[model samples]
Target: MLRRSFLKVGLAGLAAPGLILRAQATEQPRPGSPFIVTYFDLPGIKGSRDVTDAGDGTLWVCGQRNGTLGRFDPRTSQIKVISLGEGAAPHGVVRGPDGAAWVTEGGQNAIARIDDKSHAVRLFPLPAGRERANLNTPVFDKKGILWFSGQNGIIGRLDPNSGKMEVFDAPRGAGPYGMTRTPSGEIWFASLAGNYIARVDAETAAFTVVDPPTEGQGARRVWSDSKNRIWVSEWNSGQVSSYDTESGSWKGWKLPGDKPRTYSVYVDDADKVWLTDFAANAILRFDPLTEGFHSFPSDRAGANVRQMDGRSGEAWGGESGTNRLVRIQTVKPA
Candidate 1:
C-alpha cells in the first residue's frame, strides 16, 4: 500500500535535521515494495547483541547478559539456548569458516567456538595481563583467520587450525566495537569512542585510520557492499555513512526524523543499507539507487535491535530488549 507522509525536513529547513527525514511505514508492504518481513519470537534471552547464519537453516545469537549462545531455527521458529559455562558474558557470535559459531566472550575475556551441528562449546581465552578486553564482535577473513574487536580498545586474530593467537593494541586505545571484512579481504572496524573507521591489513597487521566528516559520529558498526564500500552506523550523529575504498571519498546521510539514534547497520544481499533506529523502535532501509528512505516500525515498542546481518535475501536480528529474533525477506514476486 502506498502511504503519504508529511516529513519535516530537518537538515534543509524544508520542514525538520542535520539529516533528511523519511516516511514511516504507516501501512503494510506495498504491492511493489520488495520486502516481506517475518519474525521469530525467541523467549528467555537478554541482550542478544549479535547474530549470524549457522549455514544450516539456523541463526546463532549471543546472549550478552544471560552468558549463553542462542540458536534460532527459522523453519521451526524455536530457540535453543546453550550455556557458555561460568563467567560467560558473550557479546558477539559469528559462524566461522570452520562451521562453528565463534563468539567474543566479554565476561571471560575469551573467544568461544561452538560447533554448529554438535552444539559443543570450546573457549579460547585471550593471553593474560590484558585488562578485560570487553570483547564485542568477531569476523573471519578470506584467509581463514578469525578477527575480533574489544570495546576496551584491542583487536586480535586467531588461527583456528594451528590454535595460534595474536593481539594488537588499537591506535585510539578504546571503543573498537564493530567490524567487517571488505570484498578485498582487508578488515575495517568502527571505534565508537574514537569517532573513525580504521582499516586493518590482514597479513601485515597494520592499521590506516579513516575519519568521518562529522565529529564524534560514534561509528558503532561497519559493513561492506558488493562494490566494497564501507557502510557505517553513526550512533552519536544519528546518521549512516559510507566510505568508498576505490575513490577514497566519504558520503553520509542522517537518519530520518529528529534525534534518531542508530544502534546498528547492515547491508543486505541487494546492497540496500538497513539500520536500527532506537528512537522510532524501527528498522530503516535506504535505497541508494533512488536516494530515498523507508522505515519499518516494529509491532511493539522498544525492539532495540543491536546488531543485524543478512545473506541469501534474508536478514536477521535480535530484539535485545524484547527477547525475540526477527527476519526480513526481500521478495520479488514472479
Candidate 2:
C-alpha cells in the first residue's frame, strides 16, 4: 500500500492579524548595540519553529503544531501557508538546493518536501520498522544530499535527485537532534541524550562520535562556523561550547543568567554566535573575540525560539511558545 500526500496552498498576500510591519519600531536597541530586533505574529501557524532562508526574499518556517509550512514575506507581512498533510507535526525544515522546503515531519513518520513555486507536497516514508524515528532536524550537504537526525537514535540521508534514502542506527540510542554542515563539507550532529556530537561520514553513512569535555552536557543543537569549528548548545550545562576541529580543542562559556536553559545555537556570517535561553526568555549574541554575551530578551514572556537560520544581515527564529516569528538585524561595524 502506498502512502498518500496532500497540499493546501493558502490565499496569497493575506496578512495575518497583528502582523508587525518590517519598518516598525522594534525593541529599543541596547547602548552601542548594532542589532535591531523585531517580532511578527503568526496567527494561524501554531507552534512556529525551525526556520530557513527560502533563497528568495522570504523565509520558510515550520508549523509544528499545525502541520503546515509557511513562506513568510518580511517586506509585505504576508504569509502563504502550505499544509504538509494530515497528522504532520514538522520539527525542522531546510531549503533544499532544488528550491523546495524539506522537512523532518515526525508526526507522520516521513520526510516532506514542499515545492517553492507550485507548493506541491511530496512524502518519502521511512523503510519498514523505522517507525517513529522522531525526526528532529534536516541539513543539506555540499553535494546536495539531505541529512537529518532523529531523537530515536537514527541518522538518515536522502538523495533528492534519485529519491533514494539510507538510515543508520546512531551510536548510544535515543538522542540525535540538531545537525549542520561544516564549511569543509562535513555533516555533524548533536546527540542530546548521548551527551556528545558526531561527524557523519557521508560516503559510508557512519558516525564518528566526539565527546564533549562536560559529561551530561546535553548537546542539543549544533552549527558550524566558517572556520569549520562545531558550536554546540549545551542544554544540560547552560553553556555554549565550540570544538575547534582543526586543533581538536574545546572552549565553553556559561550563559548569563543564574540558571540558563540554552536551547539553540546559530553562527552568523560574521562568526557571531546566536543562542536562545528559555530561562531568560531571550536571544543572546556572543562575541568570540571579546568573550562576552549581549542578551535580547523577548518583549513577550515565554518566547521560546527553538531554532534559527538566516541570511547575511538578518537572524531569524521561530518563537514556538508564542506563535510568532522573530528577526534580528545586525549592522556591520564600519
Candidate 3:
C-alpha cells in the first residue's frame, strides 16, 4: 500500500524579503489552460452541504440553511425540493436500500427519508434528549440497518423497517462527523472535536478511537478505498491521511498552499482522492500511487464547495457559498 505524503515546502524558514518574493512568484494558479466552469443555479439552496449520486444519474442535495433536500436530474436539468418540515437543516444525503433517499437533518435533530418517485418525506426523530443527534451522516449497512454519527458525540442505529432506534455514546463532545463502513462491516467515523478516528464493530458494538498524528487538526471526513484502507481528511490542518486495516498503521499527506481547508474527500473509481479546498476556493486531485497533485480553482473566489460525489467519470459537487451545483469532468492526458 503506497500512502501519499505532502509536506509544506519553502519560505517558512526564510527571513529575507527576496526569499518571500520568490515563494510568492511560484505559488500562483497555473497560467492559461482554461478550466471549464458550468454552474447549475439551485434556487432556495442557501446552504448546500452534501451531494450524493443516487446511482441512477439523479443527485440528492442537502441544505444546511433550511433543512431542505433537493433532487436534481442531470439529464433534464430539473430540480425538485422536498421540505423536511420546519428547521430540519438537512446536512448529508444518501440513497438507501428501500429506493428512497435518506438525509440527516441537523437543525431539527432527526433523520428523514424521501421517496424518489413520489417526493414524499418522512422524518425519524432521534432518541429524546440527545441534542448531539444533530449533524449526522447516515450509512446503511450490509444487513440494511442505518447507522449514523451524531454531532454531539453519539452513534445510533435506526431500523428502517421498524423505525426502532438504538443509541450509543462517544467521547463527550467528539462531534462525530463524516463516516464510512469497511468491507469487513466495521464503521469508521471522524471525531471532529475529539480529533480522532473512531471505529465500531457492527457485530459486537465495540468501539475504538485512533488519535490523529497531528494535533489541533481534527478529522473531518472519511472514505474507504477498494483495498479496505480508510482515508480521512484533516480540515483544520490541510492534510489527508490513510489508515491501513491490515497493518494497523497510519500515514498522511499535507495539502498544497497555505491554509487549505478541505471539507469533503472522495475516492473515484480509479482510486484517486479528490478534495474540495473550501478556504482556497479550489478542487484538488491527488494520485495516491504517484503522490502527484493537480489543482484547479472554482470560477468564483470563496465558492465553498463542501461535498462531492464521483460517478460515471464525472465529479459533482455542491457549492454552498455560490448556491450552485458544479460538475468536473476528467480531461484525459494526451
Give RMSD to native, each candidate.
13.6, 5.0, 13.6
User: Once model 2 is optimally superposed onto the true structure by TM-score, how far is the C-alpha of residue 98 displaced, in angstroms?
Assistant: 0.7
lDDT of 2 by residue, 189-287 (tens): 999999999998888877799999999999999999999999999999999999999999999999997899999999999999999999999999999
Ranking by TM-score: 2, 1, 3
* Candidate with the larger lDDT of 2 and 3: 2
Give lDDT: candidate 1, residue 87. 66
Expressed as tens digits, the lDDT of each residue in 1-334 for candidate 3 is: 1111221111111211110000001122334543344567777566777898876778888867866777777667666766667656788888998888988777767677777776677767665566646666888888998888887778877788777777777765657888897777778889888888888777655678888779978788898887788888898888988999888898889888888787788887778888887777888888999998788687776778877776757777887887778876665224
Off by over 4 Å in 1: 1-34, 332-334
Pairs clashing within candidate 2: none
User: Where does model 2 exceed 4 Å of error?
Assistant: 1-32, 332-334
Q: How far out, in Å, is residue 315 in model 3?
A: 1.4
Q: Score each candidate by Cα lDDT.
A: 0.80, 0.86, 0.74
Across residues 1-334, which tens digit of lDDT does each residue of candidate 1 receive?
1111222111111211111112112224547667777655555566776888888887887878777777776666567777776667988888888788988888877788787766777767777655598988899999899999998888888888766778888878899998998887889999999999999999877889999999999999999998999999999999999999999999989888989999899998889998999998998889888888898788877889999987777777787877666777776435
The C-alpha stretches of model 3 lying farther than 4 A from their native spots are 1-37, 331-334
TM-score of 2: 0.91
Which of the predicted structures, 1 or 3, would earn the higher TM-score when compared with the native? 1
Screening candidate 3 with a backbone cut-off below 3 angstroms (N, C-alpha, C), the clashing residue pairs are 67-89, 67-90
